[model samples]
Target: MSLFRLDASILPGTSSSAELADLVEAEWTAAHPGAPVTRRHLGTNPLPSDAWPLAHTGNLTPEPERTPAQREAMALAGTLVAELEAAEAVLLAVPLYNFGVSQHFKAWVDLIIAGAPVGSPVLKDKPTILTTVRGGGYAPGTPREGWDHSTPYLRRILADVWQGDLVIVERELTLAGVSPAMAHLKDLADDLHAKALDAAREAGRQLAAK
Candidate 1:
């Protein structure tokens, strides 16, 4: 089985989501031995911000009339889509940025939609894992209960739009230990971290079974 792992953390070295994803990938490799794992680290090497717009316009224009940049953008979109199409499973490590999807992730999603036919389910029932980490708790009744805008968007794209058999592993209060203001929640954060790790391993096992 082949795995396609995409990371969208601007700070890879310190990303909680990446840490969980590492656990997921580790479990996957343990299950599949020598299976190939393709990686795309959008944080370090992001798609051009202008690519999606160019691709969108290119698709609307006649082939002969498309500019070079448009053609390149279209080709890039095709490649991104091709990666997902070729993978047997997917692992996306996406951390919330300012309560919403990271800019890099949003760009990738836009380009993916632009590359594929309209209303296409890119994942189409393939096994997929999304490990999303947040710096604060947003559970019901919390001060930020309705402030988290990232998770729902992620679900809408990966599960609803792409139609993947998705499983999400989320960890909140990730900054409890690091931020003085959240220090009091450190114990809870540690517990959540442990649980998220366990969930990640479980998700990995599920992906391997696929």
Candidate 2:
């Protein structure tokens, strides 16, 4: 079995988002020994600034010398999109940035979603499991959840690309400190991680069984 993990943490530390992804990977590997895994860290390799212009304009092949930066940018985006297209299941570790996915994550999404039709998406039928880490609670239906564009935005994107299934694991109120409040949230996060691990393992098993 093969699984693709996308890490979108911009911070260069032991962030909760990174930990969640690691747990998912570790659980998957333990459940299905010998399975192949590919982890892509978007923050470490940011897309070229010119990539924004070329990609936004619907052009994949940009000039080499004239646009040296965009050359690699377009290539990286294309390669990542191709990998997503080839994968059976995708595990995304997303951290909310101003109520939505990180800019790095948005960059990857821009590349993949650009390939899909304006209204009808091509990547729509693949299952994706997303885990989000935030400084506070933003679950839907909650008071402040409306301010959360994280899951909603992701859900919309998945719908546009081609929807197979969507699962969310949210870790909220992370900045509240190590007091009882934060501890409660951490426990919630742990539970969410466990559920995410289960979903990921099941998705892998389903893909492998096929």
Candidate 3:
């Protein structure tokens, strides 16, 4: 089985989202034993900011009439979609940025849709997992409750738009030990982080079985 994994954390080693994703990958590797994985690190190698618009134009333009730039943009989008099409499962490690979805992740999604053929369900019913991390607490009763805009938007895109069988694993309070203002919640953060990793591993195993 093949897995396509996308990482959207700028800080690779220090990113909680990346850490949780690693746990899932580890479990998947153990279960599949040498399964091929396609990795896309959008945080480090972000798609062009204007890629979505260019791809949209490319889709409207015929292949022979398309400009070189538009062709390149559309080609990139096709490559991204092809990876998803080839995978049995997909994992996205997304970090909450500026109280919203990462721009890189958003652009990637836009390009995928633009590149896909009309009415084609490229990702329909695919087993997909979204592992997300937030620097602050956003649970009910917390001061920052309702501030988590990223997760909901991602859910809409992955589940509603792509029709993926989506599973979400979330970790919050990631800045508890690092940010002085949140130091008091360090223990809680650690517990939450551990739980998220455990859940990710379990999800990975379940996905492998499927």
Clashes of each: 0, 5, 0
Tens-place lDDT digits, model 2, residues 32-122: 7887777788878775555656654535453443465555555666676777767766778888888777777777777665544454454
Preferred candidate (lDDT higher): 1 or 3 = 1
Candidate 2, position 135, lDDT: 77
Supply the TM-score for candidate 3. Answer: 0.95
Q: How high a TM-score does candidate 2 get?
A: 0.73
lDDT of 1 by residue, 1-210 (tens): 999999999999999999999999998999999998999999999999999999999999999999999999999999999999999999999999999998889999999999999999999999999999999999999999988899999999999999999999999999898899999999999999999999999988878877
Q: Which stretches of candidate 1 lie over 4 Å from their true place?
A: none
Q: Per-residue lDDT tens digits of candidate 3, residues 62-173?
A: 8899988898899999999999999999999999998998888889988998889875677799999889999998999998899999999999888987899999999999
What TM-score would each prediction reach against the true structure? 0.99, 0.73, 0.95
Order of all candidates by TM-score, from best down to worst?
Answer: 1, 3, 2
Question: lDDT: which is higher, 2 or 3?
Answer: 3
User: lDDT value for candidate 2?
Assistant: 0.66
RMSD of each: 0.6, 4.1, 1.2
Candidate 3, backbone clash total:
0
Which candidate tops TM-score? 1
Distance from true location, Cα of 128 in model 2, Å: 1.5
- For all candidates in order, the CA lDDT equals 0.95, 0.66, 0.90
